[model samples]
Structures are given as structure tokens and as C-alpha cells.
Target: MEKCRFHEVKVSAPSKVILFGEHAVVYGMTAVAASLDLRTRMRIKPHKSRILVNFPDVGLKESWSPEQLKTLFQHKPNTEILDVNYVYLDLIHNFLKTESSDLRMASVICFLYLYSLIMDEVGIVPMEILVESEIPLGAGLGSSAALSVCLSAGLIGVLHQVQGYEKSIFEYTSSSIQKEVCGFAFLSEKILHGTPSGIDNSISTYGGMCRFEKGNLEPVRLERNLRILLINTNTFRNTKDLVERVGEKRVKYPDIVKPILESIHAISEQFLTSIQEYNQDLNEKKFYKILEDLMDTNQSLLTGLGVSHPTLDDVCRTLKKLGIVGKLTGAGGGGFALAVLPPSISGKTVLVAKDLLETKGYTCYQADIGVNGYVIEVVK
Candidate 1:
């Protein structure tokens, strides 16, 4: 029998958008979201008694032997394992053993946690991982979640193939795998954002636009082609700090914020139902109206929650003035803003919007609805 020389697993992680109820979702309010084409990719390979992790785009590289990993895990005092960077060492140490200061370590732990649990059943082997992604980090795009999911799937695939086990892909489909992957992804998100709604991973795994209510995901259908402009402020916002700050406002302005949140929930339900019924009459005019209402509602609620930063407000105002419907995506404070433009607008409207945003020092990209999520490509 030919010995298995090399095995590889490739996976893509997707970006996301919040159509309605951004901050309110944290308080049990409903939110609508979709996955974007922007994605991260990861590949894994086995080495002789060694593991190498590389991020070529970022110029990061790390390698260690299995014995070194075992020694580190064994906690043999004064043992000089490989002289890896303290940051990388801390990651492996905490992930394989304890929770520590490194976010990447926490992510690795989540991946390994699921890997150890699920791999034996599927029969997988340990392998080196090379992760590369086009999704911009800290852009409210769920790049971290993509990384975690790709890792989990790659590890699981290795275990299955190496152990001579078999599981129908259909059997692992749906939220079971999603829930498992999210569990790991959220750990990393916690280290990054303090608190994440897990919406990013949820949509990225499931694909399609969805309305999440009380932890249940209901996919929504689009009636027409919707053009969205994603504006990147190039600012990184800590999700945890933003969540805490919003929490403070909830306590401070419960009366004012509560009703707004309730209203958003109602709108989201209506939006979901409308899409489910396949209302083709839902043209650009109706879509614009709905988006406008959602934008105004979201801005007010975010302002009440005190999470709206100056850049966010400016983008919203700019979109409104230009007669385009838009709102800030994700936890606000800072990150990307999304605008819904009318289809009838001049072809130059896109260029005009881009110029206007660029003039204001914001990066812009035209995004389309209905992009694929979490695709698997097999390579021999």
C-alpha cells in the first residue's frame, strides 16, 4: 500500500453584514444578517515530528517539534523547550493546557478542544497549519471566526482520514457542526472583542441572509438584487469595550432604548416574513424604504446605547444626504458602514459615493448580496 505522503484541507471564511438591530441583538432583540464573499483560507500539512504555522501575507512564521509540544504540555519544570517567541509559546501553552493572555492561543485551544473531542471519533492526525486570508482584520467582517472555523474543519478532516473513520458530510451539516465551530470561534472573539454576539460565525457557516431570534437562525430570501456599499473607516474597535459601553447606556436609558429595540424586533420579523413569501413586488423603491427605516432606527438605537462614534454618524449622514440608504455595521463605535443604493441611481452614483467616502478618508467597496459562504474545495 502506498503510504499517505501528504494530506491537505482548504476552507474559506466569510464576511458579514447586519441589516437590522445591531446593538439590540445583544439584549435579546432580533437581528438580520448575511455573509459576504470576503473570506479567509487555511491549509494544513503533516511534518516529521514537527509542526509549522505560517502566515505568509503577514510575514509571521513559527515551528516546533512534537516532543517540544509534549514537554510544554507535561509541565516539566526548567525544561528548555524550543525557544519560540513568548507570545507563540504562551499561545500553545494556554491552548493545550490553560487559558492565558494570547488571543491566538485561546483560538487554538478552542480548535484543539473540539479537535480532541471530535477527531478520535473521525480518526484524524495532527498537522501543520498555514493560514492566509483576504478578509481585512478588525473590519467588522468576522475574519477571526473564519480562521477558527477553517482550523476546526481542517483538524476534523485530518482526524477522520488518518483514523480510517467515515462520516457523511450530510450528517455533520447544519447547526451541530456550526454550534461546535462557534463555540471555538467565540472563545477567540471574547479575547478580541470581550463579548461577541456569535452572529458572524453563525451566518458565515450557514450562508444566506438570516433573522436570528432567541438563538434560532431563520434564513431570509432576497426578492431583488440589492447593491451595498461597504465603507471602511480603517479603525479597529474592541467589541468587548463597545458591548460594555452599550450595557452602561442600557442601564442609563432603559426607558428610551427599550422601545426602540422592541420596534426593531418587529421590523426584523416583518422583513423576514416578507422575504419568505417571495414578494417579487419588493422592488428597489420598497427595499430603499425598508432600508431607510432600518437605518434611522438603528442610528437612533445606537446613539441611545452610546455606541455610535463620530465616523459612524458622519457616514450615515453622508449616505442620507446623497439619497442613499445606509447604516453602520456591527458593534459601531468604529469599523465598517454599509449603504444601500437605489438601483435607478446613475452608474456614477457608485463612483460618486466612492469619491465622497474616499474624500472623507474612508475606504469603500461595492458589495453584492447573495455571496457563497464557507465553501470547501478539494485538491489532490
Candidate 2:
């Protein structure tokens, strides 16, 4: 084990699911979402010259020099960097116009951008980071957002402790850290998805369930915990392409899509209200019904928008057979399917459901609800 030369810090960020409103959100519809326990975690260590990247779970590792990273960013102008609003895109562009691989370049640009503004208050330099994530990539679980939040919070935490900016970790709440992480996550998400509605990253960063309106995020309170099971179709969905397809549909079939969008918006409100009131009695029946309605709405709307993939349909059909209400999450097409497990469903039943899905080559996990967004742990 090459005597791991770096001290490590661990940070975890949550995954998200849109309970209601999908294709319609772009058309100004409201969406309800909750965070899942699936998380991305990163370990950072100080390094002199080399920036080492590792994804142990997938058996991938790479290293790059700072100069090479800068050049890489220059070549790929579409990369995203995070920092205070004061040092925005132009500053990053100027910095990147220098050499590197896509991943190294983009990661470094984002790391540096975050370090410059966040660490300037503390003062630190290049550190090698190894990131490991359990969250499935490109599965509409907000894995990228979780990664971004983890990186930003980890860097800021190290800088804060080193520079004496903060004395105690107890000073900041997880929710507070989530807010800061959201800023960087939002920036990174934009780089991935041209014009994301910001709901995915927001819910992933904050955890719990929320009602997202045009300009605000309202956290919903549930009386009893909700259990969700995520089934991965082992397929990737390109959010940007899906967004574009939805846009085209809006232009070509406004008459047909508009009503669906309006209905989604209304249902989203009811969903939020239901969660907030903790109506557990009606929740089992009503909640699943609402979820089914939302799924139907999403499938119909996404089908019209031409973003449904065969794999996604297969997973949905499999879940239906298992008696679980589920739908394709995020921009849809192909990715993961999220299913709501009724309280009446037993753990043994869930196992059977998982086995059936796996028999069909679908990967499934019992997702956690109300997970904490982001956290920084110091290992000295």
C-alpha cells in the first residue's frame, strides 16, 4: 500500500429523486423532491506537485501536474469552476488557458476555483484527493452534484482548520454546510446540464423532502419516515440531450403537453401538502396513488418529448410486476428508476422485489430518506 502519504478527510453528499414534476418543470411547473442516502465521498491529502485522482471502487486512478491541469481546462472551455461570485467565469477562463486530461483538468479547475475564494480566507495550496462514491454515475441520483458538494466542503474544511479561520467543527451545522455546498454543486451541475432547473442538486444537498417553486426551496415535514427503493437499469442518461428534447416538444406540441404540465404542477402542490401534514393514515393509499399519477404523467410527457429509453421502460415494467410504484427520475430517457415502497410491504417482500429485478439485470438498492446533505470529517 505505497504507505498512503496523505492525511484524509471524508465528506458525504446525498442523492435525490423528483417525486413529482419532470418534463413539465422546464415549462415552469413545480416539482417535489427528496434526498436519498446514496452518497459520494472524497478523501483529500496534501501533495507537493502531483494531483492524484483515484476511484478505488471502479479501479481507476490518474495523476496530473498543475500546469497540465490548467492546459486541459483551456482546451475544454466548457468545464465548470466554483468560487465566490466575485471571481467568476472570466477569471476561470484566464486561469485555465494554460495544459491536461478532461477529468483532471475539470476537477482541478473546480478545486482551484473553490480554493481561491474559500481558501483565500484561510490560505492553502494544491492537495491530492481520492474520491470514492457509492452513488451510481449517470443514474439520475445527483451523483455529480454530490461529488461537487463533497469536494467543495472538504477543501473548505481543511482550509478553515489550517488557517485558524474556525476553531471548532461544532460551529457549523450540517444544513449550513449544505447551503455552501449547494453553490458549488449548482455551478458544477450547470457545466453538466446546460440549464438545470436546480431542483436535483438542491434536494441532494439539503436532504429531506422539499417543494421547489420558481424562486424558493421549501422543506417538507413528514410525520413518518418514507422508504424508497432505487432500481438502476445500468444505463446512462444524458441530461442535456433530454432537456433539449423536452424543449423541442414544448415548441412542437404545446397544445398536447401544456395540460399535462399544468396537472403536474397541481399534483406537486398536493404531494407537498400531504407530506407536510404527516397524514400517515391517508399516506399509504394516497401517497402511492400520487406517486403512480406522477409516474404516468412523467412517462406520457417524456414519451411525447421523445426521451424515453427502452431500458427505462423495462425497469418500470419490472417494478410494476413487483407491486411497487416507480418512475424514471431526472430528465429521464435512461438512468435509474425510483420506487416508493408501501408500509405494507415487508423487508422480505423488498428482498424478493430486488431479486426479481436483479434476475432481469437491474441493480437495486434500498435508498435512505432524510439523509444529511454534506459533512466534513478531519483525520489528523
Candidate 3:
């Protein structure tokens, strides 16, 4: 338990969206996901005797002494097994009973767990962490995963300083560091969302587009970057609840639900293949058509899964009327819908679409798809 040489550490990780697959990916189906420019940033520095976290996005600002956190957990996490330590989490829940919001409490619990686990490598040292994020919370976007990845990388950056590593191994540029961050972030996500597909964290870690099946990630190469308009429904939904609902539906009618899942899986594969084969010089219009069609079918299947909300349908309809196709990007219910913006689309059309959506009480964000993932820097 030595002190770190660096004065502070900073890290950022991108949020992600399901480009083609959603709940279907959880069933060992191949799904496509990509990183969004939206990101969460975390900064960590030494404190006197308390570990503090200030996450203003959720209106959470809390502190706990090292001894206080230690007493709440049975032991440090086992790295080999990244599963949620229910015994420890239950203890944390009991300790944080005073916290009114479950979301905020879950964030604290995850911070405590990761803090203790990472601190085990360098002993408990008091620190203060502040997170500022561009990503919206509980919007099907990987805001939680981005937070987890950024927090983990920042903590690991501290470890790098303490261990006297000449170069920071926790930096996002390295593939190894990406894998490490993804693993820790996945565990943190499990604390937040009970049954995350691990797709969000994976895309957030490695960046670009990827094909995810079960827990495996295969990065996909894109000939040209895709543009998207992120439409926020401004309606919050519990991802765990929606996922569980789909699971229950499957259990009640496997014959009916299995086929939908299979169809969605096919759509994802087709989406991937279409993107890979796309050539702007040869047939640019055809590429957009293929992608738009896949999005339409995927949204339909998500509707059948009963996750799509009326507002989501409204979003799709609004975008489709403008010759732009869109679908719910995350767990449906009501989060964010992604609308593809073909290169040929005029800026005026995008503005018109945004103005129309805004009038309907929705927020829109313009960002490039498949952007870089996590990045870290140690401040001396």
C-alpha cells in the first residue's frame, strides 16, 4: 500500500448502441453494436482519509472511509470470477438503506466494489473521484458501462503510478488494457443491470463496431464511418425489467419467441454483411437501403418482443416520414432511437427533423458512430 506518484488520473469511455441486435444477443445470438461519441469521464486524485465520489449526472455525491467500506464487504473480489458478490452487495444494500434512490445506491455500491478490488492491489488509499458524462442515464445507451469503464481505467491508472510502471499499461491504446477495462466494467455493469449482455462494455472498451455473441467480441471494419442522430425519448425504463420481460415471454411461448429471436439474429448478420460489402463508389444508395431495411425489420421484431413503447413507434414514424429509418437503440421500452443519416442528407433536413422531434418533447444528439473507446491520462 504505497502512495501513487501521480497527482491525478483522468479517463474517458464511450457509450454504445445496439446497431442491429438487442435482447436477441443475450441468447447466444450474434449481434452488432457500435460505440457512440457520447462518453463518460472520470477524474481521480488523492484525499486525506475518505474515499469520495461526485457524480452529478444522477445527483450523487457520497463519501466513505476505507474502514467503513471494508467492514461492509466480506472480502476483496476474486479477479478470476467476476460475478457479483451477492453477499457483499447485500451487505452494501443494508449499509446504504438511507439512500433514497436505487440508481444512486447502485452506483455507490459499484464504486465501492471496484474501489476495494482495485485498492487491494495497492492497499486502501483515500481518494476523491469526480465523473462528468455527456451520455444520458437510463436511456438504453451504455451510460453505466461507460462510467464503469472510465472509473476502472482511472483507478488502474493510479495503480500504474503506484507500481512504478514506466509506461501506463492501463491506457486505452493497448489491446490488453482494453480487455482488462472491459472485464472490470462488465462486473460493474452486473451490479447495475442484473443481466447485461456484456455487449455495451465490450464496444465501449474496444470502440468501433463489433459482432457480439454470448460474451465474445469480434471487431468489424467499416469502409466508411456511419452518421446517426440519437433521439432521446426522455422516458426512462428499467433495462433489467425489460430484459426479464423478454425472457419471460420466451419461457411462456418459446415457439413464438424463438423464431423472432432467430429472425433478429439473421437481421444482425445481414446488417454486418451489408456494411462490409458497402462501396460508396459502386452503389451508395443501395447501402443505405439495406441498412434502413434492416433497421425497419429489427424495430418490428423489438415491437413484437413488447419492449417498444408508443413513443418509440412515434419516433420511428417521424423519422420514416422524412425518408430516414430509425429504431430503438437499446432495450426499447423508451430510451433512445437511432436514425441513420446518409451522407446525401442535407443539413437542413436534419435540422428540420430535430426541430420537429423537439416540438414533440424529445431531445436529439448528433454524433458519429463507431468512434474510439476508452482513453486514459495520468496528470503529474
Candidate 4:
């Protein structure tokens, strides 16, 4: 492979939201998710022979030498394809030791892990990788997934330029590159969420609406556009804690919680049906009506699982007063709640809702459903 002539590569990935089926999605239920307007962007440029990373959100700046990083991986098989496994992670754990417990430091570890693995095939060249995020961290908005996707996509993008990727008769198209990026992001997520459902990374890498069922993803179409109001509670909530609490409830009250979970599953099905109806040019009002009722039921089920917090309830109540259909998305202890607007919702109504929620001590913003997934661009 020839060396790259380009000096820099920049790539951006959109944040994602779970429209329906968050906790339920993890439990073999169907879930609907969409790409958010917010994005996390990554810019990479060649430097010396060391890896340098910049994460401004948390005041993190670090650099690592190629020799220092390679010891973390047995770098097995010495194949053309890059491979990452437990040996590398164990080595990384020992390398970071105390710092791995910190989220910021852990992310840096993940970045280097992915960086070294991908760059191995193309040969490592020193470079500066900078990240900037518009998505709020720890809000169940797929921030980590976006970052991972961007890194994988950015590095692979640079590889394309270095090896003269498009000159061959057969080469990867944009879609194939997206899947490859998502694959690496999935591996990286295992380090972030332990056992992730893959929905987050898939949506983050692809940037569109998806119906995830039993660990599989299929693209779903939206008939008419739906505008949503994403209100961040600004309240810190641990997704691991929330997911554990729900599991405990299921264990203690199997008879009681079983039906509720089933109901939640049913609601997801209903949500899918509504989308199909809307796509078929059916009644828009009727479709949103189904959504409103399902939101009420789904939120109630989440509350039963002990994932609901005061702030989440406050979000629901505020939206309820405005007659807007809202529910907590993702893990939902006290992170973010979504208010789905009606098909005929007026700008005045949206503004009023935002104003009311903001006045009530929440961060309110607007996003749309059914949007483009991910794209790569050259930085000139």
C-alpha cells in the first residue's frame, strides 16, 4: 500500500435517541430509534510517530508512543486485518490502572485501543485526533457511540487516502464503509457498556431510523416527519444503576413485572404499527394518538421498574399539562425525557412547550425523527 498524500481527515457522526424500546429493547423486544440533530465531530491530522488525543469536554490531553501502546496488545496472528481482544484490554487496564476507573481516562484508553488496532494494517503514523461533541454526556444520547464511530470512520478514511483505495476496480462504497465503522464501534462499545445491544452504535454509525429486534437491525421508514422535543433533565443518572434496578424488580416480582414487560413489548409493537400506518399515508392524527397512549403506558411501566425519578415525573407532568405526549427515553432514571409533538403541532405550541419546560428548570431542545445517518468528508 502506498502512503497517504493527504494531510488531514475529518469525520462526523450524529447522536441518536431511542424513540421507543430502551430497556425493553435489551430484553429481546422490538425498539425504534432515530438519529438526532446533534453530532460529535472528529478531526485527525498526521503528526510524528506518536498518538496524541484531545478531548476538550473533560480537559483531557494525552499522548502515547507506538512502542508503549503495542505492548498492550499481543497483536496476535500478524494478519492484514486488525484484531482486538482481552489480552489488549487486560494490558490497557494494567497500563492505566487507577485512571481506568475515571470515565474520561477510560474513554482515552478506548480511543487509543481503537486507534492502534486500525492503524496497524496501514502502519501507524503519529497524528492528532481531536473530538468535539454537541450531545450532552451521560444523557443516554449515544455520545460514546458517536465518538467511537467517528474514530473508526476517521482512521479508516485516512487509510483510504493512504492506500489509494478507489483506484482499484473493486472498492468499498459509502454504505460499506459505514458498516465497517459500525463494526469497530460495536467492539469499542463492549469496553464502554460491557454488553451493549449494538443498537446505539448501529444508529450512530448509520444515522437513520432503525427497528432493532432480537439483536438485529432493519431500516424503517417514516411516512410523515415527526418533530420531537428533547428535554434534558440535567440530572445525572447512572444507566448501569437504572438497568440493574429494573432487573432486580423483574426478579423479585416475576408474576407482576412479567405482564408489565409484556405490555411494554406490546407498546413497541404498537409503535411499529403506527409508523407503518403513517408511512402508508394513513391518518396522521390517529397515528400520533396511538403514540400518545403508548407513551403513557410505556412510562408507567418504566416507573414500575423504579427507573423514574422526580425530575422525570416533572418532565412528564409539565408536558402533560401542555397536552403533549412525552416519555423518558433510554434508561430513564433522571436523564432525558422526550416530548413527541402532534402531526399538526404549531410553532407557537412548540415554543410554548419549550418555554414552559425551560422555566421549570430543564434544558429543552428540538429534534426531528427520520433523518440521515452518518457521512464522511475530506478536510481541506
Candidate 5:
């Protein structure tokens, strides 16, 4: 390999919350996703001979030699393929020395697949990558998508250096790099999840807020960023399974499920409009009323779809007693629920709610919504 030519690159991508429309989004309904303050960070720099990956959050620490990965690349499936090549994935599973399926294994596979393909474009360079995250894994907070976006941005940053570029690839207004990052991250999401709505990767890449429907994304603007209380139920879920279950329900009772999905879609549309109106008029009371009603209705619709868990319901019900309304985010089996704190809400009220929930064995995080998406810095 040629001599290392650039300093290390550090990248971070924020976690996401699906404010409205979870499972129904899979059926072409619109979903609203916003970036949370929580994020996954990665540091990547040149190494001597082997490629190293360390992700302590999920307890994944593995290294691969260039030659071994090169051998695996030789068996790569057809370039015309649209989905993951199961043969190649099986080979990766065998190489990883694990038969059980889990997020840790999924992380490793996503890393290897992305690293190999991206490196092949800019030429192989021995590198070491270490990932640390504040986002909880499998908590419906877009943890995996954040990791994928961080890695994609970090690797592409390296690619820029290898091509003799001097400036960072990510800027607030750069659309091409943003699209590339989203594209790579979306592919990684597909590998981990057989089918994903692509909202997670898109939100992690673009940041701020977006309205996603049927593979199309439109940016949503807020006059002021929203404050949210993220509640982790401590119950992990399989997003793919939850999505599949919803699919089965739709197939079994389209009449029943289709209307529910359409209602959720209407809720998302109304929620978007209400937020925009609030942005224009700054009517906290009116907006909160509409938001609360929408949240309650959306949760009921999700419950009808059989995606809401007991823990999720408990969280919402508890919040309701305190005059706060919340709903499940992401895939919605049992992961995280979010409460949009009104701008006029008192700190004492929030603390009281947090204390009450923490006492009941739930975790709570105070975070801002619609924060910056992916960011990159040069490591000196």
C-alpha cells in the first residue's frame, strides 16, 4: 500500500425519531422523522496492514486483512443485483464465525460490506475505525442507521483524501455528498434489514426534519427546534419482524388495516400542517392541543395494527396523567417513546415526569429534535 497521506477523520451522525407514521409508512403512508441530539460517532485513520473495526456499543471488535477481504471480493455476486446477495452474505456470516443472528453481527456485516465496496473505489487502504454512540441499540432510535451514516461519511472522507482533495466532503449545503452518503447508508440498512423505509438513513444523513413517503423525501422546516423527552422502555425489538407482522395483518385484513394506515397518513399530514402553522403564528397552546390529539390518535391506530407494546402503552398512559402526550417512535414494538415538550412547559413538570418514570424502571433522556445530521472533522 502507498504511504498514508491524510490525517484521521472523525464523523458523527445523529439518531432519528419517527414522530409519526411507523409501520404504516411501509405501506406508502407518509412518515415524519427528525434528528435527535443523540448521535453515533466514528474515527477512521490509516493503519499498517489490516483493517480494524471496533464498536464497543454492541460489543463488536473484529479485524480483517486486505488479502482475506480481497479473496472474499473475488466471490462477489453479480453487479446487476438490486438486493443483498445472500451467497455473499452467507460467506460473510461464515467468516465472522457466528451462526446466531443479532445486531452485533449485523453491524460487522454492514461495516465489511461498506468498507470493501467503498475502498474498492478509492483503492484499498489499511485503516482502523472505532465507533462510539450515545444512541441505544435496537431502541427504535435509528442507532443502526446512525452507525451506517457515520461509517459511510468517514469512508468517503478518506476517499476524498486518497483522490488528492484537501477540503472536507461534508458541508451544510452540499447536496451531492449528502445524497451519496444517504445512498450508501440506505444500502447498509437494507443489508441489516431485508426491507427498510429508508427514512432512518435519510434523516441521519440530511438531519433537521423530513417528510418521507413512497421513497420520496421533502425537507420540513421548524421556526424553532422542538424539545423532546425520549423514554427508553428497555425492551429491544426486531424491526424486521415488527414490519413483517404488520404486513401479515395487512394481507389478512386489508379492509381493516388499510383504513388504519390511511388514517395514520392523514394524521402525519395534519401534524405537518399544524407544525408549519405554529411556525408561522407561534401559537403554543393551539399547536400543543392539536399535537396531543394527533399523538393519541396515532398511538391508537398503531395499537390497532398490533405494533404497540404494553410497555409503550404504559409510558403513554403515564404521560397522559401528567397532561403530556407521547407516542412510540421507529418500528414501535417496544423500544423508545417520545414526548414533545411544549415550549411553555415548565422544567419542574419535566423533572417530575422524569423522576416518576425513572422510579418505575424506565430510562429518560432530554434532547432536542431536528438537530444537525452528519458532521465531519479532520483529526490532527
Candidate 6:
């Protein structure tokens, strides 16, 4: 492998949905999560001697000579990512006359960090980086993880090409590719969620159903693909804040909160068994019932923890009234809720459900879960 100007590379990572377990996952509870079709897409191209980053999703557009990014890199090399995530998110975070966007900063940090880390081995020409995402900004749908994964995949993909890393070896074992991407995404997750649980990065990088428990992750094989109606409460919530709040509560009310946390873990455990049953037997009715019951339980536990919002409640109630099971999917102060569609559901039924939910001033996306994860393509 040798350094050479590669024409272009495109990479994308899917947003993730938590099928079961949320705040509880932090406390050794197993959580089930899947990747969504919605994704953050990034494209990179060689430029002469500077870097250009465009994020239309957040109204951020900036170009800097390599020296500028290098200066920022040296400004505080050991400054923790949490510091960058919390306050200074971009090279321009303190620059005069620049608008503030934390997402913009985080994305910029990942780009610079990964570029610098890999570019040490081989110098890269200035590059054009364009980032756009279909995933909502603050919705707990793994937006930050996805962004980080995309950048990681993009940089690594380009790195491999520039180094002329053997494609034949990477060709036979793509998991190796995902493993590298996941590692970088996890580091990026630290910038986004502070002490991230690692599930979001894993799910987004692998792009499928995973049972993540107590720091160990294993894949779950489902016989049939699942469709979920992702409804945004149009609510904004921060994962770090919600996670910290739950931690505070646990310490404050150990007896009460501990049991509840265990109960939530039980729900995930039960759901895992039910999924095995469904996959083993292809019993849609049985699995749907289990999912409905488990989601209801999960939602109640989350509400008990004080994370549920009025909008989240309304969404859940609406779905329950229609005999559709639903629950809050993420940090849940208010962000997104999900209704897993039964395998027998018809297109008309789904459309009606989406319309009814949309009429309530909510945004709805119909996406299949457990899809493929991060991907890279070179434009020859």
C-alpha cells in the first residue's frame, strides 16, 4: 500500500433504534437495538491543500487550510472529547462571528481526529467533506454515532486505499472492516455521549439486531425482517443529560430505582427469549403479543424513571388505542417513539397509521429494522 490520490469515496452509517432497554442499559441491563434505514451520509474527495466540510443539515459550511486544523489539533491535544462535545464543538467554536452548532462541532472534531490519526501514516491531499443526514438531530436515533461511523468508515476506506492495503484480505472478511469502523465510532461516541454504552456505535456499524448486555454484544438472528413506524415527538433531548439523570436517581433511591432497573432488564431478557421463539417457530401472532407486552412494560418502567414526556405519552396512548403496541425508544425526555408493525399488517393499514400520527403534528418514518450497517463505496 502506498500513498496516491484516490478519486473519491462515499460512506454511510444507519441510525439505530432501541427495541428494548434504554436508560437501564447503563446499569448492566441487556438492550436490544437495530439499525434504521435512515442514515447519515458522507462523501470525501481529494483537494489541493485544505479541507472543506459542509453540513447542510445544520447550516454549517466551512473551509480551512490544513494548517488551521493542525493548529486546532495542537491547541489542546489532551483536551477530552467530552470537553469538545460540551462546549467547543468545532475549530470555530470560539471564532468570532460564527454561529454555534454542537453537532457541527462534533462532526468537525471527528473529521479532524480521524484524519489526523490516519494521516500520520500517509499524508492526504486536502479533501472536500460533505455530510447530510436523514436522521433527526436530537432524536436518540444514533445520529451522532452514525455520523461518527460514517466519518470513520470514510477515513478508513480512504486510508486503506491510500495505503494500498490489501483489498483481497478485507474482501474475504468484512467484519474486520466493521470492527475497525466500530472502534472509531466508539471513540467518536465519547465526544457525543460522554461515557457511551457502546451499543449505538455497535448497532450502527454492524447494521442489524444485537443483544448488548453488560459490555458484551452478540448478534440476534431474526427469521423475518421487522418494520417499525418511527414517530418523532418533535421533541429534543440530550442522551448525556438523560443518562446522567438516571444515574443520579439510582444513587439517590437505590432501593426503589435498583428494582425498577432490574425489572427493565427482565423485560429485555424476556423479549430476547420471545424473539428466539419467534425466529425458531415463525409464529407471528405469538411474537407480536410478546413484543406488545414487553414494549408496554418497558415504557412503564421508563416513565417510572421520569424520562417520559407528555408528547411521548400521547404517542404511546394513540398507538395503544389503535391496538398497536408502541414505546419511547431513546433517552425519552422527549425524542422519538416507535410502533413495531405486525408482520401481517397491510400497506393500507400502515399508511393510515402514519397519516393519523402525522396529523397530530408528529413526523413519521416507515423504516425496516435490522438492516445492513455501515457501508463504503469508491467512485471509480
Each candidate structure's TM-score, on Cα atoms with residue i matched to residue i, is 0.79, 0.79, 0.87, 0.89, 0.89, 0.86
lDDT for residue 367 in candidate 1, whole number 0-100: 70
User: What ranges in model 2 sit over 4 Å off?
Assistant: 1-8, 46-51, 57-105, 166-170, 174-178, 191-195, 279-307
lDDT of 5 by residue, 1-380 (tens): 24445679999999988899787778788999899999999999888898899988767788888888888777665433435777888888888877637656888888877776766655567889999999877777888999999988998888777776545484333787888888889888999877887878988998999999888889999777889999998888888899899899889999999999999999999999998898898578888889989999999999999989999999998998888999998788888888999988899999999998898899999999999989998776
For model 2 the local lDDT of residue 180 reads 68
**Per-residue accuracy of model 2 over 1-380 as CA lDDT, tens digit each:** 12223346777888777777776666666887788887888888878777676767656565667665555333332223442342354456555553323443555455555544555543335577787788876567677777777776787666656655454332566555666667767776665455666776787667788877774688887656677888777777787788887677667888876776777677677667666554545646766676567666666656655777888788777777777767777777777777777778888878988998899888888976766667677777
Best by lDDT: 5
Error of 3 at 234 (Å): 2.5
| Ranking of models by lDDT | 5, 3, 6, 4, 2, 1
Candidate that beats the other on TM-score, 2 or 3, i.e. the better one: 3
Candidate 5 to truth, TM: 0.89
Using lDDT as the measure, name the better of candidate 2 and candidate 6.
6
Give each model's whole-structure lDDT.
Answer: 0.66, 0.68, 0.84, 0.78, 0.85, 0.79
lDDT of 6 by residue, 94-136 (tens): 5423344454566776666666655556654578899999998
Better of 1 and 6 by TM-score: 6
Candidate 3 lDDT by residue in tens digits, 199-278? 88888887899988978888898767789999999988887899999999999999999999999999999987787778
Residues 336-376 of candidate 4: C-alpha lDDT, one tens digit per residue: 99988885888887888889888888998787766666666
* TM-score order of candidates, top first: 4, 5, 3, 6, 2, 1
Please give the distance, in angstroms, between residue 86's alpha carbon in candidate 6 and its true position after superposition.
13
Candidate 3 displacement at residue 141 in angstroms: 0.9
